[model samples]
Target: MTAKKEVVMGASTENPAEIQDGGAMELVRVPAWEVKYKLDRNPDELAHFVCCRDLDWRRAVCGYEEPEAVILENPTTFCTMCVEVVQAHGGVPGSGRCPFDDQPCPDDETVDRMIDERTSRP
Candidate 1:
């Protein structure tokens, strides 16, 4: 069998009128704290965070609300109740529940405790 050559697409040419003679491109700056916080979180967690942001943006931009569902397959995923809330609010993949709230617990420490508990158990 003969090997087939793949065709490549070229980059589109830029418009001359779009370029400014003296004006320089301005870079929009996001807060350093936000960047640092985002980086410190796990990639999967970050994806969920971004999803929440996108949901908010969608609501603001077009008044369109996405249906949210809580995935409870994994401990890391959101709880079923939270998913229902997200769906009611028109969000997709609602925020997860704290893993360590058997009776009553603080939100911040629950995740770390849950991780420890899960790791210790198995």
Candidate 2:
């Protein structure tokens, strides 16, 4: 079995603002501050690292299995450079290729299709 891993955010924290719902139903709106880091790390790399760390470290603390991979809303914009770094480390970018293999990266259309499929799913 692949070794389980967890990622933990080092110096980043999220704060949310609560807003009242205007509709008849009682609702609370919690607007979160986007994830932010203290160090000058590449955003994508940071995200990847955090994901890995969470799977490798924090999952155990929280009592869960490590996630195989993370999904980003905008894969292209979120971690282009980090993908390159992960690729250099032998991992595939975009298609979840093994970092230790030479598999071809998934094309943009594949990613788009995945996004569309996910969004369309109920």
Candidate closest to the true structure, highest TM-score? 2
Q: Can you give the TM-score per candidate against the true fold?
A: 0.20, 0.29
Give per-residue CA lDDT, model 1, range 12-111, as digits (tens).
Answer: 2254443443222221222212221111223233112222112111111112222332211122532344344445555444225222221222253553
Residues 23-91 of candidate 2 have per-residue lDDT tens digits of 311122111122221222233432332232221222222233335322333212333454565556756
Cα deviation at 3, candidate 2, in Å, is 21
Residue pair clashes in candidate 1:
67-91, 68-91, 68-92, 78-96
RMSD to true structure for each model, in Å: 18.9, 14.3
Worst 10 residues of 2 by lDDT: 24-33
Model 2 has an lDDT value of: 0.32
Candidate 1, position 2, lDDT: 6
Off by over 4 Å in 1: 1-34, 38-51, 54-76, 91-122
Off by over 4 Å in 2: 1-46, 49-71, 75-88, 91-98
